[model samples]
Target: MKNIKLIIIGVLITLSSGCSPELESVNFEEISPAIFPQSEDDIEALVAAAYYPLRGAWWDGFHTTSERGVMFINDATTEILMGDFSVQLYATFHSFEPIHESVTRFYDDFYNKISANTLSIDLIENSSANENVKKIGIAEIKCARALLSYELFDMYGPLVVAPLELLKTPLNEVPLARLSNDEMVSFIEQDLLDAAEDLLPPSETNYGRFSQGMARMLLIRLYLHQKRWADVEEQANLIMAMNHYDLESDYVGLWDTQAPVDSNEVIWAIPADYAGTSENQWQLMVLPSNYPVRGGWGTIQSSWKFYDSFEADDIRKTNLIAEYVGTDGVTYNRSNPGTNMQYGPIPLKIAEDAARNTGITTVDIIVYRYADVLLSKAEAIANKNGVPSQEAIDLVNIVRNRAQLDDLLLADYADIDTFNTMILLERSHEYWCENGQYRADLIRHGKFSEYNIDLTGAASETAAHKTVYPFSLDRISEGKGEFLQNPGYN
Candidate 1:
């Protein structure tokens, strides 16, 4: 696993640098499958390469490839965050523009990763390796592919669920039509279920590796998106039964840069080198201009509405720094967005590391946490019977209590509608920039549009077609009329 991490780091650096012509000149015949996978290390290396794209989705610092910008994409587009409108050229916040570079790059790179994952699976499955390696390796790669597919589906609806057998087929013979939205969901669910069989439970696998916990956690999110309330509840319970994960007792320390890497709260986290080998670039995007540590680009900050949404005494409010004394002895008020270099409520959840001026930090990018399971189970149960159950209220209180806030009783909420609204709000506070789950949360509650947000030119309600984003113009051009772009873009 350490070797795999080193390989990932090396690959990212090479990718961040210019391409190599010498590397390109090497013939495909020199690296055919027959010669590779002769050893376990070789197989692991192949699997590691498949996961390389996951890091590219958020880190690597490249303008076109770094998905770290997704932090801006998810938050700025919603009502919870704000940046300079002039600087918000990506259009995820201002308007749903199909030509946005980040959207196109994100879409293209994810598909590229899916292709890499498929090829990795083909190589491992066909190799004469130990059966256990084949099983677990293939399972992990499949889960990785499923994760990428889920994100793609979330962003762009009804994309091609590329056939596994196509791994063996020539590109010229491959078909590229997309699955129906329902078919795509089923395909992803089936893939995750199949993956769960061979994976160890959470914390049993290597650091940064996928596990049964991640599989079921993802399934819970999938079911929630589909409004499969019963399934969501069942999946969350299944994860709890695993008994390998629980919330970190110290809610504030969980986000601390120096927190333990093995915190029980984290079900799955993408590892980064605190020593600066590999890093999460989010701090570079979110920290204010004059923060105590190394400071950052100050591109994104919390919206005043989001800052005010928290309870006055809630410890989670520590995630938002309303005012702070800078190293330069200037007292900054983050509540005012109009002043020069001033943006409302800075998201200090991801702290800055003073050691590196490059904006890279040791913070692990978390994908799944046990607290989310609790909150999700709460929401699912409340919706199960169209009324907030005692169990639902108790589950929510578990999260709230951890945040040093008082518990809520069933009487606090007037009806199921009100309870559901609070649950979504709780999720916004707890999981802010963790996994991009908040977007799905908003869409699930039917609040993902201008109806809830205050964009200047937003339509009265979000168009049904706008729920899923449009296909990039490059992808459409590459398909050359074979692919159908999402509705409203054309």
Candidate 2:
């Protein structure tokens, strides 16, 4: 676990060759504050490449030195420990156990590049480039930096507050110690806010650069965490005003590879070029034997809780899951086990044919989908005066309409408690496990204490203070105490 800090605060060096015959001619100097712009396009391309890891795939997917694979262990708890035993490594990560090991490494790997990204702004400025290119390069780096922090803070921050015993031995390292849940929240918020100022507007960044829409989405995310109701409303409204995005006629279009970027409700998205550079989320999420065999390397399975959240009345349930065609050659699932086809909502949100990990394809995640913005509006309205407004009901209904549903009933709630609960259920039905957004959402609504209902048996056995994970002892060993442990895990 000592390397946890090393991972979190990753280094940026020439991709290592292990057997180095190093040259000293390339000067390593401080980044100058000069503003230049020639490298802007290069910066944009780099940002596009960075988005791959977030999808839980390979290449831009999970890097081994990092805890990217460890998350597989953590997510498995929701499935293997809680669901069917079809996958083993899945449940091994229950809570902090698997998480501690992988995340520490991931932190180092992620930060190393991100920290280097900061220096990128200065390099292009100093390079023989124009002003627009340099400025844009810096902006892209800012966005990259925010994305990296968001990933870490998303998984470990609140969940694993520290001063933890930290991992010691290679095998049995973690022990426990203080709480810094709120502190973690602040650190994450600060990064997003700083980045938003420098990010390019979604329209300007073009195909794969950070845009205003991304910034706006991030703002809403930060505000939600702080319980800054009005600010959430403000940012969401500004984004909505852009009028650039509209819900796709078919909700499932968001995941279609044939679909163009920003054609539907997507405000900002990564363009996974299955053609050149590629990735397949199916490799990480689909079943082993699915057609073409999504790399036959299924790691992250969908949770029944996530699937069941949809009311049979909601159309999203059908469109979101795979069209289960079993050995019988059916396009849909059989209602009963005896039937030829059996299906329980696999990740249709990823590429269909790419369901095999071995396939060459890339699937973009909808970072700031239109529906998400609408929902943020709904949350803001409902959180006002500790009571939901009719405005809140309107927001929910807009999404419901897009989902092919009728009116929502939240407007009738007599008080804030009922209204708040109603909004959460709405959020659940709309955004569970989509982008690993659920964990942060749970905390936003102030239910972090009560919400991690991980049926993965180990969560039940954990110490009450076991919420925040301990720092990786590997990090401590490498970092020499530069990074502190999370609460209670030492």
TM-score, each model? 0.87, 0.74
TM-score of 2: 0.74
Candidate 2's C-alpha runs over 4 A off are 1-93, 98-100, 124-128, 158-198, 290-300, 319-325, 328-345, 354-357, 446-459, 462-467
lDDT of 2 by residue, 1-490 (tens): 2222322212232211111112111112232224322344444433333343443334434422112443343333332112233322323232454344443555544544443443443445466665665555555555655666656655456322222122112243342222255665565566556556666656555554467777678778767766788898998888877767667777665666664554647765545445433333443444435433333333334545556666777766653453455434545442542221232445445446543334444555455576888888887877756777778888888888877888867547757777666667676566433554554565565654453444334444344443334555655455454445665656
Query: What is the alpha-carbon lDDT of model 2 when measured against the actual structure?
Result: 0.51
Clashes found in each candidate (C-alpha, N, C closer than 3 A): 2, 65
* Predicted model with the maximum lDDT: 1
lDDT of each: 0.68, 0.51
Which 10 consecutive positions of candidate 1 have the poorest summed lDDT? 1-10
Top candidate when judged by TM-score against the true structure: 1
**Model 1 vs truth, CA RMSD:** 5.6
Model 2: residue 117 alpha-carbon error in angstroms: 2.1
